[model samples]
Target: MTTSPTAPAYIHVLIVDDHQMVIEGVKTLLQGEADIQVAAQASNGPEALRLLPLYPEISVAILDLNMPQMSGVELSRAIHATYPQIRILALSMFHDYSSVTEVLEAGGSGYLLKNTNKAELCAAIRQVAAGHTFFSQEVGTTLLANLVIPANFDRTRDAHPAELTGREREVLQLIAREYSNSHIAKALFISERTVETHRKNILTKTNSKSVVGLIQYALRYKLIL
Candidate 1:
């Protein structure tokens, strides 16, 4: 059976980017779609905050890093705290573990590379709006490879042992050593699907939105180290 595209009752979106060209281009594309509407545009994080409360129907917010006055991560945290319902999608050029981790830690629902195709960008927005986390293939690949955090913060492991179950910890050690899920599962005598399930549980218990965060949590508390 062919499924129909879900039409939002009303889609109010806010685009926060520094370049005029990007803002207009995204607006042109989204506003032309059937039900999605470009409700507002902001050049920087400050403007995004000022505009957000005014546009209550905003289902998704696409944010760009390197904006003046405030970085996207800073703005994302504020919005997440106050407007928990709005899905935050980060569009940025930095693809390394550190950069993606910041957005995830700030509570973004998804992360996309700036070079992501228009179709994938649109799909990511819809995915987040439907409450499923989304990530670019590049981002996801890198996430599984590296995870690092500042030297200070306590991992608060006591608050989240479910993520670091004995089996998960074993898997995480191999992951920290940069082993692929397949390799880890085979070496550990488990199926890849079981490995994936453990990975999912780790993310859930640690409140990690991505594989990188899962690794960071694993490393921080010495589970992987």
Candidate 2:
């Protein structure tokens, strides 16, 4: 007589937004998910910080970019510094690179536009809780659109594009399209570690500094349209 395996614990979430309606709407959307629970809600950054102590089970925080006194970026930075274990997922109406990048630099694990559907919101929460990054398709598109190339930039000065293998090119295209490593792995039928290795190799071969640089490289070499 052996006991059955234990069930996985639910991912506890804390929703922080200045608008009460938005918070309620998010809670309603998450209510039907069996593996996710809305543990708490806050109307602002200070309130969120105050409530954090009371809800230690919260593993993910959905933050709004704009708030009255403390912006989501500031709140994210504060929460990350104090509660590094809690992952932050930013939900914003703004899809611009500045807002998205600010939240990310402030320790957000993911970013989703306010127009995100129930499925994406839940997926983002789950991914962030599991220590993975997630971004909405629209956000990814915006990031690609905003990649700036210098006026005098010369591709010849960088690593030769021919050095990338076929698999490396595919990985670069997906990365330019803003697909997360997990999504790329699933699409390519490879392990996440393999996808990561491809990414590192691509970066090295292209002599790219960041995701933006990779996208720029892909654009210049026509690796991705």
Candidate 3:
């Protein structure tokens, strides 16, 4: 008799924020997700750090940006330095370029606005947990508006345009436009798995570390306006 295939492991998460209400809100939003678990919670950076060692199964950390003792950026940096395996997803009210950039620079894998709905929040957590990046639409817009490519940059010389297939290019364009995988799949009349494959190929061809990098690449190559 053949044994059944093993199920995928749960995506354990750690929620960190100074405000108890915010933590409770996140937990409530995540209650319906069967595959995602709130493995632990902490009110500050130090508490979060202390809890990490205890919960070795935690794969993601949702951090609030403006905590008193240690800011989200600082916590992100510290967590990245020590627990590189734990992907960080920053939650903040501010959609400004500086705040978003700070989280990315500090090694955060995703950024979500505090006002994000349950669907987007869960999607972002899953994306970051899978070693991919996600950002709120407003945050993406802010990044695109502020990120300036060099005036003298040569796309023909610098970008590997020849490496990307036509389908990959299409995916990249939609991605720069902030379309989700499901939306991209629907638009292209392809399965989400196919879209994901194209996404991976696009990132590999462009050497993009995250969505931010992919957007910058698109801008540099004039793939999107």
Candidate 4:
């Protein structure tokens, strides 16, 4: 018997920002990706909510945190409540820990700075669409420097790299160094599949969604020199 072809994963995204120029810029950046499509665009939070129902294929929403009328935080919560299946990725110029925490707590699946590069932004959207979180490296570092860890917190037992195994830490450090999966696999004498498995495990163990977050945790707790 002949098997049917697998369906392609839909990665429709909605861009919500107050500025048309920002929307246009993001659209231009995303134009090269075949798998990712801009399902809709909105200038404000209310318009975003209105447009969302029309784009049922939108798996992710890229939101600007400083939009007028409805902020990204509020939009994130509304999206989470109304369309819990759609993941929210917050975009902003703010580098403060409070802003990042606010977005995440408001149900954002990932966060990126406005100045993020094209590759990182696209990667972040895909990651969040796949039910994983992502954060820009700069944002991660800022959060690490400003975030307050409780005095009672133990790195070994806490939600950071302290919970990771030695092998996982090695993988994380490689990740921090910007090593690709193939490179990591080759360096560690492991298969690419195994490397990917280690990556996922590290993310879960550290409660981190991206390499940036993992690296920040490592630096914050002195897990690596």
- The prediction achieving the highest lDDT against the true structure is 3
| Candidate 4 residue-wise lDDT, 1-225, digit = tens | 112112238689999998999999999999889889999999999999999888888888999999889889999999987887688888999878878877766767678988988899889887777555577888767777865555565666774445677677777756654456887787788889999999998766666655546655666766643
Report the lDDT of model 1 for residue 222.
Answer: 50
Clashes found in each candidate (C-alpha, N, C closer than 3 A): 0, 0, 0, 0
What value does the lDDT take at residue 69 in candidate 2? 85
Who is ahead in TM-score, 1 or 3?
Answer: 3
Q: Write the per-residue lDDT of candidate 2 for residues 144-173, one digit (tens) a residue.
A: 677665565566664445478878877775
How well is each residue in 3-64 modelled by candidate 1, as lDDT tens digits?
A: 11232666678899999998887776665566577889999988889998888999899999
The TM-score measured for candidate 2 stands at: 0.68
Model 3 clash pairs are none
lDDT of each: 0.73, 0.79, 0.81, 0.77
Q: Which stretches of candidate 1 lie over 4 Å from their true place?
A: 1-8, 147-212, 215-225
Q: Which stretches of candidate 3 lie over 4 Å from their true place?
A: 1-8, 153-215, 218-225
What alpha-carbon RMSD in Å does predicted model 4 have with respect to the real structure? 9.5
Better of 2 and 3 by lDDT: 3
TM-score of each: 0.64, 0.68, 0.70, 0.68
Cα lDDT of candidate 3 equals: 0.81
Worst 10 residues of 1 by lDDT: 1-10
Which model is ahead, 1 or 2, in terms of TM-score? 2
